[model samples]
Target: MTDSARPRRATLSDVAAAAGVSQATVSKALNGRDDVAAETREIVLAAVAELGYRPTTAPAASSRRTIAVTFDIPASPYILNVLQGVLVAATENRLDLLTRLPPDRAARGQRAVGRDWIAEQRASGAIGVVGLTLSHPDALLDAASEASLPFVMVDPVDATHKRLVSVASSNWAGARTAADYLIGLGHRRIAWIGGPEASDAARDRLYGYRAALDAAGLEIDPAHVVADQFDAAAGARHARAMLGMDLPPTAIMAADDEIAVGVLAAARELGVSVPRDLSVIGFDDTPQAPWTTPPLTTVHQHLDEMGRMAVHTVVAIADGRRPVSRHVELATSLTIRETTAPPPA
Candidate 1:
């Protein structure tokens, strides 16, 4: 055939472009690298087939699978504990676990950026994704859906997408239990310090606390309710202010263990002895909860189980099975420690 009439042969670059992945990823996928996610491999293979691209070397066979997990910075005990469960489940399932940070906030809201982010995940061989306390995930979730990638969120923050699948602790019930316990302890002036206003878990916990007070026929004290960051600093700041009030609360309920730690610090600074002058209760019985001064009495949420469930849910979705529910809430129990007692007379 004349050179002008001959069809152009497809190159590796063409396949990579078609697959929306890097050339390195294409090679890894073709070579059956264990690090490549199964879904990513399938994408590359499809591109190769569509473009009729052929490598000089024959492709290798492999059965490795991977999932991607994304989280924010300054990882807390709750996050670390949940990660432990994710790692264990990934190992048990014989899958590779990839950890990542989300894209920059400035660009993540753009549709194209979100799509590219999902493509990168697919390129890395991730068939599914798990997000831990990921905030503003609507764009990413939309892109994942368009690409048919399975995604699960654990304790998501500020996520409003209706199709989101997630796993979390029973926040409302847990908080209510904590409040009731304080009431049972003869602590009538109860105060609440909560997590961020945008957190659904935080809102649920606050509602639970209110519900408990209502059930006990106690009036809600707006002055005693404070919503702020989930860190110890926010907790300490709020606690100090509340403790300094002319009619101070006899007990305080914190949204998480970190915040509860700050509450302890503030009480100490003010010379208020725990369970003597005041009682404190916190949510999320993370590993650090038991190590707090006087060992914090907090609500026990199975964080690891939530992580394990997230992996299982994503894997099941990838297998073309729908989850039993879009949202799953694990049970919570109260872990009584040295920080709670009857209110000082």
Candidate 2:
């Protein structure tokens, strides 16, 4: 065959044929769809690599793409990380991104602004919606399902209703990691400062803290578990209450970095020395964790990965790919810093 006549490019169809799969299967495997079996998907990927096939980047295809992302709060560092991953991936694919913030940041609530936003975007030909920490209304979830808007949630919803497509870090595991760290350091008189009553994360964190105590053959002190909102001020309030108790705890676990900082401040005000008179461990290792006075020992939530997964799931669904489940949970790790230590003698 003449060099000019030899095919210079392998197409998706060629890869599918080589892997003995459908064209759609090849697309799913290449696009990181979670629907395909791991082994079969790996085979398809290997075939793609062997065939040196690349997806087309024609303007016609590029112009057909747009995504709307709604976040629970624009001010949250965690949400900011999620947004970064979604925006970076979308930009790389030459997709248009429309970011929406909740109507009232002060209300500290998530409004399904996504539904109305989705309607307008759909009028302009948007393909899907990606939401981070989305506390969507039931009607909005129903609307997404009816409209087939390819909705992807960043994490699990507090209440159960179907139609939630999500990719999330394991809050339970993150909390467990924090508890394990405290246990390993010989902190037996531990307490937990949780978030609001309605938060899925707050519940998971509380469970983990209790699990660790149970494993150590310790009874959970009801008075030691203080649940509050997910803010520094709330943390301070809870910490103050805990500190004021006649028999205060030796260590406290906060559900987030902000709460941990509040605890630290409260400890100082009450003349309690961290890691000496008291120990504080937290979750979400926010950027502020290391900056805290004694630094903070906390759980490392993979927010960037969560964001990427949410975007990938939404975009894949938009392209007619079905994921394995409506819910996806990612893993989390622990970051041990200087804040926690053995209880005082």
Candidate 3:
């Protein structure tokens, strides 16, 4: 599509002018500043909605040094939080940031992103890329290397590849911490619910769990380890299967919050009381974690920091600076909520 044919993005200034208020007033109203009058806030909001104004706190890009954050799927549930962090960094750095939701064929893998796509990015002044889950494709990397376009991956599916520059949480350490916490609670029979076995994060977390078990002289129960998608449905299915065992686990550590929520559902369905009879722990600590029936005990991954650092790394690469490290792994911590307690007598 031609530039002229594209819809013009409504700015804060546009909203301010339409609302008959100063730009700062519009900003305060949008940000919920207490000083803004309720009537003025409503006017600004109405103008914003009418004008289709989207906030981009960042300064405009001068048609040069634009950074593209590409995703595998447009509606991937986890991108919103990460995008916020990226935008914050983009704003601070005064860089133009845009998201590219590649078509399935263009996004499946690095090799899948065709030569035409690379040419298009180069033509559009996209000098750097921050990829969510898209890993190293030799061809795409080669094209990037030749074009000197810096590339960085956020939470890649496989982070072990030396060629890949990725930002990820300390999955192994977080998993180990969860396992140890369960052991500390006097739970002998602990089950694990993890995502697809192929994922590096999942694998690392699984290994960490096992490492903790080994350290505590507990045998890893094969029946308790289930590999499924990181969703409530998968959690429910796995939890049900585990709960059906004659000697079910007293505690279950799920790899993601969605799965943890699923475990809670299965527990409720099976008449298993959380924490009293069965303790549950999850990772990622996404927003939904705290709202589950009994709340969720989770390992928090600093996703926003990861997003912020991703922009910083990619921008640095674009600026012709060689980073001291190609990969960055942020720390993880445990958030104790309502779902975990000492095992039943």
Candidate 4:
């Protein structure tokens, strides 16, 4: 294909030729590697821009500096809160940050999408990865080890890998605190609503609730422990089902604010008044927590603090600090709102 008919792709050779430099020099300069003369590097980049060459889109590996942050799940209040912190830290460190979502299971393992995404960035000289999953990608951990790139995890991990830095909140402890607050309110026949059973957060929160109830010598009736997705509708359904039982729970502890809001809807629909008929508590005091019909009482996760900490941890690792020891766990508080009150007689 001629230049015009040649598919419009810009290659290292094309950039080198345009800048009257060697391909090796173009590669080094574009990749931000040392040894290329500063002036030569500038010329190659100028030519690259003049030709409208997008490094990331190139078939060959990138020859530009890039950084990436990824999550197993898509952007949610949880992920984005941390992502905003990652961006601030990455920018402060003068690194370009790219956020990618892992592909569905059909494309895992050999396709190991996370590693591929990071590798593509590596080919362009990306030197850091900020992972928001509670677990880190083993392949990604391996790749970073091989490349000596910085790998910062935003949450806890069961397995350890070199260059694995993490910043996390004490989900278990926070959940316990939340449960304790509800228990202190004299709520004995408390019901626990859980999220996806497989989620680390859900597991921890559930453990917290069980621990407190057990300490109180209370038997946890499995029927009262409902599992649902982290949404208001699911919470509503779970609450409705629980309420329809021969004997319903007095207070409900939802897995999240969304689920708690659903509980509110369920109460209204069932002609049960909150605080008088039912007491509700939610986790993750999202912005909407205060707007729920009765202003949901919830655990105030330090989302901003979490985000700021993740950014700090990732950036510190990128700057060559010993980051593995920096497992900072911010505390959460129970924000008393209108939704929760002493259970009625």
RMSD of each: 7.3, 13.2, 13.1, 10.2
Ten-residue segment with the worst summed lDDT in candidate 3? 55-64
**Model 2: per-residue Cα lDDT over 1-345, one tens digit each:** 899998778887898899999988876665546788888776775665456454553223235577788766688777777788898878766678877653444432333443443344443345767767655344555555655667777765464557667777788878887887888888887899998767777888888888888888887789889888777888888888888999898999998887888899999999999989898988887788888899888888877777777777777887678886777877788888888888898
Q: How many collisions per candidate?
A: 1, 0, 0, 2
For TM-score, candidate 1 versus 4, the one ahead is 1
Per-candidate Cα lDDT values, in order, are 0.88, 0.75, 0.79, 0.72
Clashing pairs in 4: 30-63, 62-124
Give the per-residue lDDT of model 4 (tens digit) for 135-231: 4366666655654566667664442554456666677777788778778888888998888775667778889888988888888888999776877
Pairs in clash, predicted candidate 2:
none
Using alpha carbons, what is the TM-score of model 2? 0.77
lDDT of 3 by residue, 129-158 (tens): 777766334455554554456778888765
Scored by lDDT, model 1 comes in at: 0.88
| Model 2 global lDDT (CA atoms, 0 to 1) | 0.75
Q: Candidate 2, residue 315: CA error in Å?
A: 0.8
Q: What TM-score, to 2 decimals, does candidate 4 have?
A: 0.75
